[model samples]
Every structure is written in structure tokens, then in C-alpha cells.
Target: MTKTNAGRFFEDYAPGQVIHHAVPRTIKMGERALYHALYPARHALYSSDQFAQACGLPFSPLDDMIAFHVVFGKTVPDVSLNAVANLGYAEGRWLVPVWPGDTLRSVSEVIGVKENSNGKTGVVWVRTRGLNQHNEEVLSYVRWVMVRKRDASSAAPETVIPELAKVVDPSDLVLPKGLHFDNYDFTLAGEAHRWDDYDVGEKIDHVDGVTVEEAEHMMATRLWQNTAKVHFDATVRPDGSRLIYGGHVISLARTLSFNGLANAQMVVALNGGAHVNPCTSGMTVRAWSEVLDKAETSVPSVGALRLRLVATTGAPFALRGEDGKYLPEVLLDLDYWALIPR
Candidate 1:
């Protein structure tokens, strides 16, 4: 018997089956430092312990996306190591602050699966939760990926497409304990705009761009411990280029949004997201965001804004085309709820 791991194929999944990802990562200041180096992340709450204390937290927690990346990275071997593409996401939530030194692992349950017409690939949907060492869930999300089949003649599994929410209800958003912005400092936040400053349908061009370097993409993927072959193996795809990890684009887009949304700290909920186009190294990425909706949370000092963040290489504010298909220039389209000072 071979000891090497080949990862799970599409046929290996079944509804209701659970998988405990094999790796548990202990995140620290070093991860934060390297994350900051990989992306231009500068949210004050995550930058300074003093700022976080002023905002009523004991200390600055890791950036919300750091928890996300760590959580996402751990699930790759079991969930997406054999994936052809990670298609979409829905109903995501960041439940607790991930403090420094917190160890995190992931558990995923197969929720849906369906074989495609070609018999060469199938789509698998799973609800994955990132749990701390205490077994407390820090983050959760539903994502579906297209995976290749190990045997073309294998019988198809029962089709089950899960009913998913298009948006995470604001009432269900979990706020970190003791987090308040009653005395928020706009000066330190880097942008004067508060939750009220943004109107629904308002669009903000972040007005910045970063060229993705091949080495940086490789480094970022390795930093997250994402072991997908597509990111590291240029020979996997017909094109002789390594595919940049989607999380890299997500972080880069979030980093670019800081210019206009500096005060929009703490990502609380991820409603949905899509990797519209393939992103490879050497493409310059730009970002824009539109306020989709707004709601008041129970926290007296905090409010939530639902924003559609778009990362693209072409132009700002251009998404779908006449056929309702994503434009060729768009890379990622993510919708999430963020907390802001009231």
C-alpha cells in the first residue's frame, strides 16, 4: 500500500459525511506580520493594541481575514486538493475574534453534490467551520467546488443541491464581546466616513492597484498552507502558468478597499462571493465597492453595512455584461457585512 496521500475525489464525498481536516495551525504575530507584508492591510483595530483597547477590546485580534485564510487553508487537502475550481460561497459568518496564539482547525460536512453532464467532473458543496482549540467556532461558510472524478465510469451519487441564503441576516451577525465604537477615532481610523456617510448604491473607487508577482503569489499560498496543486503546479493546467489563489485576490481586494473604507473595520458576515475570472500572476488588481444595504445592530455603538466588493483588472464599477455574465476583466465579486462606528 502506498503511504502517499492523493486527496479526496468527487466520488469520495457524500451528504452528511463529516471530515476533520488534518492540520491545525497556531496563528501568531508572525503570521500577521507576513500577512501584512503580503497584502497592504491597515485596519487600526488590528494594527495597534492601544487602538483596540480604546475600542474596548483587551488587545488587537488578528485581522478577520487572517482567521479566514487560516481556516480556509486547513481544509484544502480534504476539500479541494483535487478540485478543478472553487466555484462560489454563501452564508458565511465570523463569530469570534481570533486572538494571537489561538490554534485553529477546520471541520467540513458534505452538504450537496451533483455529477456534471460530461462525467469528467462534479460539484461538491460543503459547510465548513473553523474551530479554535477550545472547540469554539470562529468562522463558518458554505462553499462549493468543482472536482474531477477518479473514474469516468463510476456510478453517480444522489444529487442534492443545498438551499443557501443569498445574504446573511444582519440580526444573526455575531459581534465580538466588549467591542464598541462609542469613542471611535476617525483620525486614527484613516477615513472620516462613518456608517451613515455611505448611502445604499453609493460606489467608491478605491483608486489603487497592485501587480501580483509570481513569487509573491507562491509565497502567499504557502503562507496560508493552501496545498492545492493548481496554485503551485504550472503543469496542472493547459496553460503553463500557476493560478493565483483566490484567497490572495480576496485579501488584496480587501487591502485595496482600505483607501475608501478604512473605517469599515471588522468583517462580521460574508453573504456570498464568486471567483468570476481566473487570476494569474502578473495581473494588476484594482478594487471598488458599492453599498448594497445597511442595518443597525443591537450594539448601540455599531452599525452594519452590506457592501459588494469587486476586484478587477479592467475598470471600476463594471461587473456583469449584457448577457448577465461576469465581464472578462472581473476577478472576484464578494458581498459581506462589515461593522462601523455609528
Candidate 2:
């Protein structure tokens, strides 16, 4: 009997198949400390327990991205081990706040699949949910990845691409229980800009850049427990360079946005996102944001802003070119909804 286990390939997935991932993680203060060290995340709600309590939370909750990374890490072994690329994300929601000492596990259902015309690879879509020790779902999202087929000669499965929403309805966003921003402290939050201060179609240049280092990216990926070969093994790509994880760019860009959007605190919904271009070590990442829209939430003094966050290496605020294709300089394009004080 074989005692080894190889990860899943494109042909191994079928619509409606469910996968329960392994290794539930119990998050603590160490994860929070390392996250702050890895990225320049300084949002007040996630930084101070007193700040969080004043907003009606029991105490400070872990950064929303912390829960995202933990859940994403658990799915890598089963979902993306043989992936060519993690293509995109859509319709993601944060259902519950994750606190210290909460244990989390991941469960995924294969939602759709379509083989490429070349037959060497296929796109697989899965809806994954992160659940706590009490079996309550904390987060949910849909992401699709391009995965290599183990045998190129194998027949392709029937195509079943899912019809995903282009954007999450503003009314559907979940606000943390007891969250009220009426008493939000602007001085401590580091910015005085409120939700009403931002107009639709406005743009803000974040004005800060960070040069990525090989060691830093590797450490961040390892911390998330993402075991994707393309992120670690140079031999996996023809260019002979490890590909930086897309989530890394997302976090970097979000942190950079604090310069002008310090009050856009919690990311409630991921409407859509794309890793537009491959990023490697040594690129200087700059970020910018465009206010797409805004909405009033039922929660007291809490509002939502729809923003487009773009990450680039050549310059800030340049995205698609004349051909409507992402420019080579563009690294990440993310569309999401965030909570801000009204």
C-alpha cells in the first residue's frame, strides 16, 4: 500500500464534490503580531482593544485578512497544489468577526469546471467557507484557479461554468454584531475623512511604495501555510523565478491605502479581484484607489464604500491600456466594499 499522498489535479474535480480541508488552526496574538510586521497594517479598529470596545465589539478582533489567510492556507493543499495560477475571486463575504483563540477550518465545494481548448489545463471554481470551532461560518468566498491536468491525453469533463454575481448587493453586507460607529474616534483612527466626505468617481494616490524582498514574501507565504509550488519552487515556472502570492499584493495595496483612506476600516465584501500580472521579488509596489460608489447601511453610523484598489510597479493609477487589456505594469486590480464611519 502506498503511504504517500499527491494533491488534486484538474481532472480530479467534479461539480458538487465537497472537500473538507485538514489542519484546523487556532489563531492567537502571535499571528496578529506577525501580520502587522509583515504588512504596514495600522487600522485603528484592528489595532486597539479600547478602540474596538468603544465601537461595541467585545474586544479587538483579528484583522479580517488574518481570517482570510488562515482559511486560504487550509485550502491550498487540496485546491491549488497543482494550480497553474489562481485566476480571480468574486462574491466574498465576512460573516463573523474572528477573535483570538478561535480555531478555524475550511470546507470547499467544487462549483464549476471548464476545460481549455488546449486540453492541457482547466479552470475550476469552488465556493469555500471558513467555520469556527462551534461550526459557525465566519467567511465565505468564490475563487477559481487554473490547474494542470495530470494526464494531457485524458478526456475533458463537461463544462459547467457558474454564473457569479458581478457585485455584492450593499444591503447584503454583514455588519459585526453590536457595531456602531457613532462614537468612532477619528484622531485615534489616524484620518478625519468620513464616508460622506468621499464622492463617487474620486481618486486618491496613496503616495507610498515598498520594494518587495525575496525573504519577506517567502516568510509571508509560509506564515499563511500556503504550499503552492509556484510560490516556492523556482523550477515550477519557465522564468525560473518564484511567483509572489496574489494575496500578498492585496494586503500590501490595502495597507498602502491607509495614507488617504485611513477610516475605510473593515473589508466586508470582495466583489471581484484579479491578479492582472505576475509579480516577483524586487518590484516596488505602489497603490491607488478610486471611489466607485457609496451606500448607507442599516447599522448606526456605519456606512459602506465601494472602491477599486489598484497595485502597480511602473506608476500609480494606470490600469488597462488602449486594447482594454491590463498593462504590463499593473499587478493587481481589486474591487471590494469596506465599512467606514458615517
Candidate 3:
């Protein structure tokens, strides 16, 4: 059996392809600790075993985004290894809550593919499902990536772009079953900002930069049970460079958002996001967010705010394009919706 290169080309992907990306991940307490340190996430469901037990779980689970990354990271090898840009994501939902010890594996089915007219790139859309050790579907979502063509001179194929939602409706939000917070401790949760405090168009700068280390990411990947060759086994890469798991950057940015957006509790929607550039070790990550829109929710205590969070390494606050493109040090541009205290 021939192994596909981790740096795959656009010409290599086809519609209806089912890619069972390699490596399985299992979440653990160390990863949980990192979550606590990375973000000021103090939800009782994730912070206390006693609280989780009262909530009917034996132990607290990792954050939902952590599970999302554990599952999404696996698809990088097959879906976006050679991607020019991550186009967008849509219809994402977390079906089941992930526990600390749950082992996760993901499978992505290619739903659409379109070659570019320029003949240098193409787009690939895939619906990915994250399954736990018990084979239960934990989360699922549709993501598309713009992939570079290995042979740019080839004729372009028929275009097939898929339609996607601009925002996931509040009714579409899926709260973990039994996720009631009658006794929710606002103190331990950190910060007093609630759903009503944030206004649309407001900007918040999360003032902290976590300097990443190879060992830190390696430990994180291992904690999630994500053993992708590029993420861990350095010898497998031609350049012998270990690719920092994109999830690490995502988590770092999300965690960093806690400073001013601490009340932006749950991530209700992921409209779009991009890991614009590679993040190597020793890069210090800093994040800032702008509230795009605000919406009322049935949960009166919390309102929803649409935000764009930017993560950068060494780049100063506020993204500027000298050449009309994102600065080289900019690591990510993410658009999402979060539940904030009302």
C-alpha cells in the first residue's frame, strides 16, 4: 500500500473519498490543566469532579473545543496538508460531550471538489465526524480547504462549490444534555462580564502571549491521543520539522480571549476560521477580538456575540497589510459566536 504524502496536492483529492485520517487521540487531565492555564475557563462542569458528579457525570470532561481539535487535527494529514488556505466551515455541531478520558478518532468524507480556473489550486469540502472509543459520534462538522494543485498546467475540472450558512441559528445551538447551571459559581468562573455587557462592534484585547515550545505541543498532542507523524514523529517529515497542531493555536487564541471576553462562555457557532501561517516553536502567541454582532438568546442570563479573533506571533495589535495581504506573523483569523453573560 502506498502512503499519501502529508503534503498532499489538490489533484490527489476526489469527491466521495473517505479519508480515515491516521492517529487516534484520548483526552486527559494534563490537557485539562493546560486548558485551565491557557484560558480562564472555570466552568464547574470542567473544573470539579464533585460538580460533574452532581451534574450526573463521574468526572469533568475536557472543553468542547478541545474535543473538536482532537478530532479535527487528525484530518489535517489527508484534508489540508498542502492546503493553500482553509476556505471555511459550516453546520458544526457537538453531538455528545467529551469526558477527560475519552479516546477520539475522526473520519472525513469528501462531499465536493472543484478545480480552479487558474489550474494551480482546487477546493475540497469534507464532513468530518469525531467518534469516541465507544464508537459514539461526539462531534461533526463540514469544512473546506483550498488545496494547491501538484500539476498547475492541467486543465481545470468542473466547479462544485457548496452553499454554507453565515451564522448557526441560536435554536441550532446544542447544549450538552444536563448542562444546567442552577448552582453555577460566577466567582470561580472568573470575571463579572455577562451577556448584556458586550455591545456589537466592541473590541477586546486579551493581553497575554504564550510562548510555545515543541515539548508543550508534543505533550498536548499526546494528551489528545493525536499521534500524527508530522505532529510528533519528527523523522517522518522531510524537513524534520514537527508541525505544531493547529488546535494548539486555536486553543491558545480562545484561551487568550478570556481576558476581556471571559464572559464569552460557550462557543455556540464557528462561522469561519483559518490558521493563516505555520506556528513553530518559540513563537509567542497573542490574541485580540472584535465583536461583530450581538443577538439575544432564550437563556436570559447569557447573550450571544459574534466575534473575530486574531492570533499573531510578534505582530503588534491591529492587523495591517503593507502589501494588501495579512502580515506574515499573523497566525490565524477566526470568526465565531460565543455565549456571554447577560
lDDT tens digits, residue span 13-132, model 1: 999999999879988899899999999999999999999999999999999999999999999999999999999999999999999999999999999999999999999999999999
| Candidate 2 C-alpha lDDT tens digits along 1-342 | 988767899999999999999999999999999999989999999999999999999999999999998999999999999999999999999999999999999999999999988899999999999999999999999999999999999999999999999999999999999999988999999999999899999999999998898998999999989999999999999999999998899999999999999999999999999998999999999999999999999985999999999999977778889999999999999999999999
Clashing pairs in 2: none
Please tell me which model should have the higher TM-score, number 1 or number 3.
1
Q: Model 3 TM-score?
A: 0.80
Please write out the lDDT profile of model 3 over residues 1-342, one tens digit for every residue.
867465667877767788887778767777778767654455545677776555445567678788887887788777876765566677777768888788889999888889876778899999899999999888888888778888888766656676777767767766556544454556766777766677777878788888988887887776555545557766755677777777788888887887887656567667777777878788889999988888876655456788899999854466658777778888888888776555
* C-alpha lDDT values of all predictions: 0.95, 0.95, 0.75
Q: Give the TM-score of candidate 1.
A: 0.99
Give candidate 3's whole-model lDDT: 0.75
Stretches > 4 Å off in candidate 1:
none
> Which lDDT value does model 3 have at 79?
80
TM-score of every candidate: 0.99, 0.99, 0.80
